[model samples]
Target: MSYVALYRTYRPKYFKDVFGQKVIVQTLQNALLHEKFAHAYIFSGPRGTGKTSIAKIVAKALNCEKAPTAEPCGECAVCLGIDKSSVSDVIEIDAASNNGVDEIRDLRDKVKYAPSVGKYKVYIIDEVHMLTQAAFNALLKTLEEPPKYVVFILATTEVHKVPATILSRCQRFDFKNIDTADIEANIKKIVNKERLKISNEAINAIAITSEGGMRDALSLLDQVVSFTKDEISEEDVYKVSGGLSRRFISELLQTIYQKQPQKALDFLNQVLQDGKDISRMVSDIILALRDVLLDKIREDKKYPELNGLTPPLIYAYLDILNELQQSLKYTTSKRAYLELAIIKMMNHQSIEYVELNQKIDALQKEMHNLETRLRSEVQVKQVESSKNIKVQSKSNLKPLVTVSEISEILNQGDREKKNLLKIGWPSLADYEVPQLRGVAKLLHEGSLEAVGANRMLLVYDDIITAQNMLKKETKEKVLKIINSKKQLIDDYTVLLKADWMILKDDYAYQYNAGISKPKLKEIDLHLYEQDEDSIQEVKLEEDPLVEFAKASFGENLVKVEE
Candidate 1:
């Protein structure tokens, strides 16, 4: 006799032989043990997950010589006949080929007959979702009210296609993908029984590649056994399965993370040169990233290449690879797309670097502006003192909020209210009031630092921008827009990013040291409002070109050559 395939040779003949579906097996056993099994059952799940195999086992359990038993006695004539497909009473139908109203009608006509040999007659339909609407309709009434001695079991990988009308009439059992460990153990048992020369690594490789499918694992193992002459190795599994080794994947990820584009390109070229599937390589990278993400969440250090990487960065990597996977399907130049994806990931690191440089430049400019303004004010003070005239210099301008007010706001900060403002802040750019929309747009230059019961803090990298946002007209317009949407905030203030950082650090230090916060009096809103007359007076007095020259050339480099 010709050698049978491993999957078929090791097909489960009894309930005890099935693996990785303990709950389903136990439920079926209890139902059978009490002789309360349903007349019609629907089994659904992914391929090779035992949906059809379990259906067969159920058929044997119902028709075995020892009827109503949880485990079928494969030695009995009825069980043997059912297993061999020789029993007239146990009918296995491939709905994919035989799905039709006439075939179903014929089945309906035959449901009235008594069992030919066993105590019960069972109909097992595989891929029942393939049945046409008319066919399903034909089987509906018979399925709903089958004879006592007759049982119907339908199996499909896609249960969503199964009509609700058909689903409502039968007991549904969803088979899950078998766990990898269980699949590995089962493979080991088979190897030991067959005395196959295979390494543990090879077994593990097969188990992972199968992706929770027992039939797939066994089939892959069979292919490897046939391809190898001696003891099977992990490399042999990878070669046969067209999958990359975990080490190669790790190395590739390290190159990508370390921003070594040449090495990444070399890895892709090697994969292409060796006739490996580019799409599969992308998929494997995604799976590796997924593993790294899990390790990150669990606070484990399994993937060292991803040690310092944050979850968002890993997600971005996965997103790039995922897009590559999708693009590979449409383009014939798979290598080009894969190469582009590698470059994209390597370049991802530049985004944060660019933003950091921008913030640094903004802070430097703001510092220079403040320095020039302070020097101008000092010169003006000297001029005024020489003339013996009282004048209010810009240097005398008060901050939008005092330290006490900021402290109070910090003490009264509400996390929930802050989150609400942060979430809604993005919408301010499109405020309904067209006149105030520009003012609202200016707020986006900064960030919502903290929100309190009645006060909100905005922080900007540029001091000038922060000061502009604090002006009475801009502040009023922004407040109007914000209050029109959400009436949570009654007042708001702006601070330089540097100042906000200092305040945040201080707040954290004080709170951690268990210092009791003192309640300060409510801030006077009028103090934050700039007087238009005072601003016009200062602008008229200060020389615009002198200010610009001071900002452009350093204060030390510029001279008053009047």
Candidate 2:
């Protein structure tokens, strides 16, 4: 009299009718035929993989009046009763709601009674992982040593949460996620049987979005069918599901790759305006990038847009987008954050080089903290000592900048001498490659000093920037880009501005060169917390004891220990 959902209407009544999980079905069928079925069985896998449906089919087959048959006789009273969920002997328990020691104890009491009409009294407990420890302990004995007429079937999406004692007592069968092709085929069979007119694209879209879940796919189809009177299309599926189109994603990425920040931002606004979730939009972007990466690696020519994109850049896109997606949950203004992240990603020189910048920033912060700690320790010692006592001056101590001695090359033959001689510094900013362009811009912050046969040295205004130049990815990208222009050097190193002043003095003293000794100031170190906008304050529940102490002690005397 009432319309049933597609998933429920098409629920498998027999093993042959179940889509996907062929191996599991065959195993159960053979076990039933050979009379080798286990007293207790465990079916575990991802949701919508037909764990419960398979359990019901097995129950019907075992309890059929036909007796020990591989296939149940649907006309028989026992089979009909099980199918209608009216059978007294075949019980289906929702462990998610009924999981308790008392409930399990009640089940144990009922298990001793013989079947009313069939050979076996079946107990199918779904979501068995929800059972508490005590409930599991109660079920363990029954599962391990049940009556001859009893069979226990436990199903869970998460098998790990099931107790080991309960697991050890059952014969386990792991259900795999249904393949997309199998899901598509299953949908097609449903469409034809139901006389529903659906486009191939709609079917494919449903299959892809279901993500290997048959019930989910059917549910989506049912929703689409209810929305559209006839002739379902891909657009209808996307509209109903709030999914993005590949064309729009491809266009957005193209705009970003071309460094059109405003255009990309506008497009992002359009997507959000259309009621798409910001987090879901980021996920779609990441998925598109993943497809491009796979296409590039496999050289499949599936995504022509990814033809020239480098793997490092693709990886960088994934990393930044993933971080953006994670940060969205903490903010109320999702649109603003999404816009800023998109603009940064588009304008950033190389996705890979961002890693180097983050590393440098972290290291610089750590170095400053270390310096502050040392300074505080020195000040404390000075205070402890007599006020008239003189402390040693750190001003005269030279900055710690070390380099390999060059005497060996200087004393070598003409070839070595020529190889070690300085050459004119080339500008890296003019490189064409995006990866190269980014590295070159960062490298431009320092002054190039000398170029040897295989190595070069440069000086930077700060120690941290110089250290960043030495990062493996940054260094490799710099060398690759520079070498592409001219094979001048293969490796390079950096020196701080203060240290460069000392090096200039050495060169002037040793070679009688016109280089002058430049005076340098020690860097000022100050500590500050990271940007307030980026820091998310998490609400942690207070411990009951701490709360009680604070309430009783007027909050002032309460000291919370870490």
Candidate 3:
């Protein structure tokens, strides 16, 4: 004459009794009616979703004399045996306790025998993922080709740990967490049956505490019921559960709205003094603040999933209190943390929240102010630089290129006179070669073709030679040269283009490697393949400085071998 816990007392005995598992129940039922059940089935999902319960139901449906029936008659002998867990044909194993390879081998041996009492022998293994690798291997062969009269039902909370080979052999069904609404409805039925006068709010609190686990929810209800034989109160539920009252939490917000830090701390201190846990207090606060935050947004189904808690209250609660969660463990003094948190909110101007929204607003304002100041500073610098440039314009204009007198290199000769103009005295091409420091030298000397106004092209006498010199590294360096100098000529629309107008016999630089023909082909093939599916075709445009990149690397690097 011992009391059966509420969860077990109300455990689903038939498919019609299982809550929030209609989808899974329907699939199994259909499979049963059609005689299409798999030899091995894997049921995987979160806790309390009834993986084992469904497995048992399947066992019952299969073993019942009249089945291929969706609703197994609990009155039948086979159903009664399964209900009592004494069915010879149905064996339930906890893989967590018996996860050794030997256990799996033993099960495999047992599965080969014919059903002793029913049409099929069903083995339901819970926590199947806990089985060791060798156990999984041992189970796999049986799964692949089990006797027609044998069924293996493997249930697991974590399916990923199950080996792919085993998984590949079984039919997998993922169970989902039961919704709060479903749990709440069931709790109401229980309260009605027990003849207890319970408030909707107290029932909800229990549902939320259960966190979608029906057994936990019912166990909690059983505990709450023991407090009073005929009735349960919300206060009694709160006191027993170690959770904050929704009103106490709602009042915390009223304090925040009123901007009363002292009063708020006093309320928080009273709650802690009443034996309420600070972590649980913070958790309650976070939930309240989240509700408050949600109030400012759209309402989703998750709010209803909160049992009986109202949406607006949850919104207000989650908004203001979720803040204290991270800082909860840092303080030994719970009242002090509450005191500090409330005081900081009271003086929003002085608080430093690294990621706080208030601080973010202030920081954004600060950023705008700083940006305006930086822009003013940059403008001032530019003006001063312009003034300095005017003063030095005359001196610097003396064609600072040391070889400025060599008109061919500068490409700035006298077009009208048909001869290179000499400027800056002593035939001015002499401004220190303007150091085509990077691949600017290659462009200056002539190698690829400038196909776009934005491109620096280098063209050779033969296309093969031009493509050959476009080594991956060399192309990158040349691109940097084109972009950098093009930035210098702000208004001119400067495009770099190079052509070996004359195969210069005078320029000679020996290359250590062979033609590098193989490397060139690989590079072209790689780049070409990427563009083969679709090409960005456009009218070819010209750039002016590409002659420099090809030539700068040395004449042989770009010019055809003559």
- Which of the numbered candidates is closest to the native, going by highest TM-score? 1
lDDT tens digits by residue: candidate 2, 368-465 = 88665554444333322323332222443332333442222222214442343323234455655665687778876667655555666666654346
lDDT of 3 by residue, 1-562 (tens): 9978877788888889888878888998999999998999999988877878888888999989898798788888888989898878899889999999999889987887898878999999999989999898888888899889999999998999888998999998988878889999999999889888898888988887777888878888888888776567777788778888777777776676567877888887787777988778777667656665565456553233333343443444344445666666676776676676666655544232322555577799998886655543433332223222122222222221121111122233223222111111121223233543434444444532212222222333322233333555555554444444234111111111111221111111111233211111111111011132243343333211223334445645764433
Worst 10 residues of 1 by lDDT: 382-391
List lDDT for all candidates, in order.
0.81, 0.75, 0.64
Steric clashes per prediction: 0, 0, 65
Positional deviation of residue 523's Cα in model 3 after best superposition, in angstroms: 76
Select the stronger candidate by lDDT from 1 and 2: 1
TM-score-superior candidate, 1 or 2: 1
Rank all candidate structures by their lDDT, best first, as comma-separated numbers: 1, 2, 3
- Highest lDDT: give the candidate number: 1
Query: Which of the two candidates, 2 or 3, achieves a greater lDDT against the reference?
Result: 2
TM-score of each: 0.64, 0.61, 0.57
What is the lDDT for 523 in model 1?
31
Instruction: State residue 142's C-alpha deviation in candidate 3, in Å.
Output: 1.4
CA deviation > 4 Å runs, candidate 3: 296-345, 348-562
